[model samples]
Target: MKKETLFIAFSTQKGGMGKTALTVLMASQLHYTKGYHIGIVDCDYPQHSIGEMRKRDTDLVMKDEYFKLQAYRQFSTLGIKAYPIKECTADKAIDMAEELMQTSDKDFDIIFFDLPGTLNSPGVILTLASMDYVFTPVSADRVVLESTLQYATMLNDNLIVPQKGNLKGLYLFWNMVDGREKTPLYKAYEKVIAELRLNMLKTILPDSKRFRREVSDQRKSVFRSTLLPADKTLLKGSNIEELANEICQTIKLENHGNQ
Candidate 1:
């Protein structure tokens, strides 16, 4: 039987919601920890943040003895190199991914797209419409919440309802949660979201400076890297692991990890 691959994206209209960070984190976690094959399409063109980060990670791993040794040990143990990250425009993202699937030596279990922040960009909507699932990272802020709800509603109503594309599910997850903030605010948002009939992941990621930390010679262990899975110790309390598991289960992905 032919293997099935799911195309997913972490997207939202507004920036600074940890979309790219979560994309890398989840891809790394699922690939390294859960033993899944993952690929990333950096469709957030121009900056291509994920692609640039992969380049910087390559440089740091080459120069830093700690990261270099870590990479070597991981590859030797896993018997696989780091997952691939491809860069392209939004419009060509689907075609690019299909090409990768055909050309790659190993079959990918999931292909994630890191998309541009604005929907106004050409092909952004098309790219999103093609995804099997789109998980939007949202916060408790008023402006961000409003924008996210509107964006999700538009997609749900226009593309999803009309069955225009391959999109199967649209989910919203709470990211960067500040414990100090009042609980009532979140409850209110939950009420509104429930009334709006939006699907939400049960896992809520906490606000942590670690999310901003990337591969560096100065650090002993990496928190985020396109080439390396996050250190298990660093992942504690971040809820990233839970989030990954939740997404996989929600998508009903069969666990095909080599482990």
Candidate 2:
């Protein structure tokens, strides 16, 4: 049998939902912690945030001796390879994924796509529909909630239900959660979840100043930053380990059933 690769996308029709951050966090955790071979496709047209961040990361690693040393140690110790970030337009995304899976020397075991935060982007639908799973980050705010629900409904109507097996799963996870204590927004989120019957992941990431400022200035992720290890951080910290584990288990279960 041919090798199997898990294709996942962090996408939504709404912006400012931390889609790129979540994608980087999950990819970092899986690659550094779980030792999975992975690559990211930055498909957000006009503004490839992940690709830009990767470039910044590379520049930092090369420019700073301390970061270079620490990064080398981290990668060598974990036996993890540097994965490529491919900049793809929406029209070429599916083809790019196929090429990566079939021909890329890395032979990535998992591929993550950071798609445009809109529905009208060219080939967005085609690219998203080809993925094995699409996870949308949703906030408790009313505008975000409404857009997320509408986006999910659109996917279901246009691709999932109508095409049957085109998209394996569509998942939603609460992002930027406030705290452990139940708040009004939390309650509203619960109500929305019930109303839309959202298939939400159990792992919810908390709001953190670190995540908010990570991309532009620091260009580092909390989970897999060369500047800081997993143990050290000022922010509330990321729960990406739990999220990664849950996703892995789910994927395994799905693959087993398919067999």
Number of clashes recorded per candidate: 0, 0
Candidate 1 residue-wise lDDT, 48-104, digit = tens: 999999999999999988888889999997776899999999999999999999999
Q: Where does model 1 exceed 4 Å of error?
A: none
**Could you tell me which residue pairs clash in candidate 1?**
none
Candidate 2 runs further than 4 Å off: 180-188, 213-237, 253-259
Q: For each candidate, what is the lDDT?
A: 0.92, 0.73
List, residue by residue over 96-201, the lDDT tens digit for candidate 2. Answer: 8888777776556678988888778898888888888888888887888888988987786677877754687788888888876577767677676767655778
Q: Report the C-alpha displacement of residue 170, candidate 1, in angstroms.
A: 0.7
